[model samples]
Target: MSDAATPELRRLTTYPVKSLDPQDHDSVAVEHGTLAGDREYAMVAKPPDADHDPTTASVGGQGEYVNGKRTAAVHRLRSSLDREAGVLTLREEGGDETRTFSLDDPDALNDYLSDYFDEPVSVRHEPRGGYPDDREFDGPTLVSTATLREVASWFDMTLDSARRRFRANLEVGGVPAFWEDRLFADHGEAVAFRIGDVELLGCNPCRRCVVPSRDPDTGEETPGFRETFLRERERTLPEWVDSDRFEGNFRLMVNTRISESEWGQRLSVGDGVELLGTRQL
Candidate 1:
């Protein structure tokens, strides 16, 4: 593949728990829809306002799924899981103290997390479930670093990778700006994600939410991120497309799922991204 056709993976990040600190890796194993340990365990929680509308947030408990979007305080917590040992640890930033729990025990895990998050939470993991945003195992998420820098420039903010709200399993380098958006986000085009011996379908553009505006390190919200993103996208939106027909949000990434012949493959940072087809305008 030509240089433009090949994008290089720069980082592989996994979130063992949804909406917690990212676990950075030089290489990771990709399954049907997720990295091996990514979001394997998420804090099942109730709504901030369960008393008003119990049905909408009820998962047989007071509320339902809790995440950074509803509770930004989660952004303050960092998580690490020892899959082999079934141990998960949550640590606060700038503090040496840590809270450790065993996934083997459900009761204690929920109790400990409930207190720490200042909300009633039940620590839950679907042993057979791959806890990705696309529950259907549609794909893994990818965000380009070049695209990150572009967004940063729009807001006149520091180009700090840590500040990037878009959580992507694979962060890539090379390719022109917004290449992924064209191939998938804007047009929902299918492309080949090949690296080493693995193949994934660049299925769809990931939808966005308020979660990305909050800083994962401090829980502080960045203003104008959405506005800037929408403006930038408007510049690139195809004239033929109905504005409302597009699937993803103003700030979004592509979802890539493992394709046939490579159900479980190990992916490394240096993996080369080879686009198989043309990008729609």
Candidate 2:
């Protein structure tokens, strides 16, 4: 294939637990509607005790998911997962102590996280497809390497930091900035694309949340990060990008859904990506 017809998959990242540090993989299977291990485990909040401070605000409130979007405190916790061993290790930024726990022990894990957050919490596991942000299009998220570089330059941050902030599942190289925009069309439509042998339908530009505005390591918010990003994103938007699907400027990567036939397909780094055109959603 010509260079323009095939972009190389430069990286594959998955989050074993939602809103935690990402884990890189050379290859992974497409299970259910998403990458096999992506967001397979998530921490959910439990009811607060009677002594709990009522004045304090929890974005999602009790009985909801605890994530970076709900609270910046989620950023303070760093996670590393050992898939084969089924163990998870968590550490706080700027802290010397690190704790490891077995994935099989939900009570212990929940207690540790609950203590860490100073609230009642529990671990939820869904090995089928995990807790994806966009359930309608639960496939892996896609972004171009050049797009990440461009975004990093705008914030004066490193590429690695930008990657952490965006948390896309697939990164394609050998393409210009915002090249992934071509993967989607107008609203109610989808763009068909293939990576290796797997096919996916790019539904729309991902609607971003508050998580991207803070430092991935620290819970501190960046001054004017969202404002600056919105301004830059609109100014740099490619002409071919379908603006109809973009209700606002708070969008970045492409959210996609997989075909049942493509389930169990293997995707690896260096896989060639090809666009197969668009269709009505």
Candidate 3:
């Protein structure tokens, strides 16, 4: 389909952590593009597990390595948050036993985490649910399969390949290709979301990091395909798209927030969402 045509939205998913397995659901409560359980828990490295100094480090500050680059070790341990139990479980890839720690119970969470890594590792609850309050931290991000297919088609790859690179909470199908890049707003009252303290900004195309190279399913490392996608973007898309060059194929929607107060109160999985009109600036 042409980019100008109204694209259909299909499929939605949420990853509770950076590289942990994604949970597929028919519908989800949205608090700024965050599906109910997305990114609620994260695992970090400490003294023995990592060489970095933890004394001066803030909780979750160890996510980024030296510069903006993230460490490979972050991708090595798989973690997930159990919303019902409020526990964060971590285990080595392919390891049989999983250690569960309570996110609500800080002492137990940190103690188990600290022992597991053989270093001082702590856990923090994702305030605003999974949404972060800091502007520096992009709050409540959303992406669509239409956008994924657009980038994948440009690179002569499959939609599945693009999805692996652009991990998101929801993937609406039936939306026209690349329609997500232009979705500034939604007019439907049925589809409302709100986040406390966290402002929702439509993300610009997220720069792909090496994390995509690691197979979320297998935990095996693969060569980065982001460079190929970038090369194709420069060749096919107009210069405007290239003006803000990023590694991945996803685009950002800016300056918008959903009415999330009624989300869990009214909406549930399998609830039909209709797109009335785009939100205007």
Candidate 4:
């Protein structure tokens, strides 16, 4: 809450493989919360369930997979997304080899993934031919250190610990908590990114999931630390809707037409960012 702690810039990271793990980088390309190499591959059900509709299967959100529930198990398989080569690679932990597929060929990707998972897992393209129908993002998803600090303070933990729980693409320094709701970066110039053409919405304060409780490095679950922390500190916030559902830390810029290619063309980590003001929606 002090001005002295606000930083003008911050580090950015992307998890090329969803749920598998996040890879941090000094700077990355951001377009609608997706870094170039993030989440290009997902494990999908090979055959739809009795009432399931593959065509309309939801991509991101809670419990759209087996048993209609989302858990760390879905991401247990290790995968990586490579942008330059337009490829999605997969390998089992401690396995001898890796499997690679081109996002350009959906059929081949689907076949390979299905066989690999011993189920009907498919590779979904990123920026998937101009964003899929299920995408909940409106503009770019940004986070500031101030916001992280506030969330940490609420949870009585260090920022490093919180960062592991709420994974954000851009972790900027020198801005107020939740400033991304009102700021935008234009052509690498920091500008107030308000929700005009773009819808500015905060993610439900993220419900602490088992993923954070499970050490990504060790693959072991700690005893009730995350859930206990949430109960004691973050449970009262507006974003914390209830015991089972907490608001997501990942915010969204909705109803905007910021194209991924256009956004990619303009922004990069370390680019100058400007804060416009509080949103007026």
TM-score leader: 2
Q: Report how far residue 5 has shifted in candidate 4, in Å.
A: 3.1
Candidate 1 global lDDT: 0.67
Output the worst ten-in-a-row residue range by lDDT, candidate 3: 189-198
Error of 3 at 62 (Å): 9.2
Model 4: per-residue Cα lDDT over 67-94, one tens digit each: 1134444434566666678777767666
Ranking of all predicted structures according to lDDT, beginning with the best and ending with the worst: 2, 1, 3, 4
- TM for every model, in the order presented, reads 0.81, 0.92, 0.62, 0.60
Residue-level lDDT of model 3, residues 1-88, one tens digit each, is: 2444433224556667544555666655655434566665544444323543322353474532111124444444666666677766
Compare candidates 1 and 4 on TM-score and give the better one. Answer: 1
Clashes of each: 5, 0, 26, 23
Off by over 4 Å in 4: 23-40, 47-56, 59-71, 106-112, 115-118, 126-135, 138-140, 144-165, 174-208, 217-219, 235-265
Every model's Cα RMSD, please? 4.8, 4.1, 6.9, 7.5
Candidate 3: stretches off by over 4 Å: 1-9, 31-34, 44-69, 106-119, 131-140, 146-164, 184-203, 217-221, 238-256, 259-281
* 1-281: candidate 2 lDDT, tens digit per residue: 23564598999999999989899999999999899989988777874332232113224443567898778999999889998898999999989999999988666787888898888877777788888888788899999999999999998999998999999999999888899888888878899989999999999899998888889999778899989999999999987665588888889999999988999899999998888988877
Comparing 2 with 4 on TM-score, the higher-scoring candidate is 2
Locate the minimum summed-lDDT window of 10 residues in model 2. Answer: 49-58
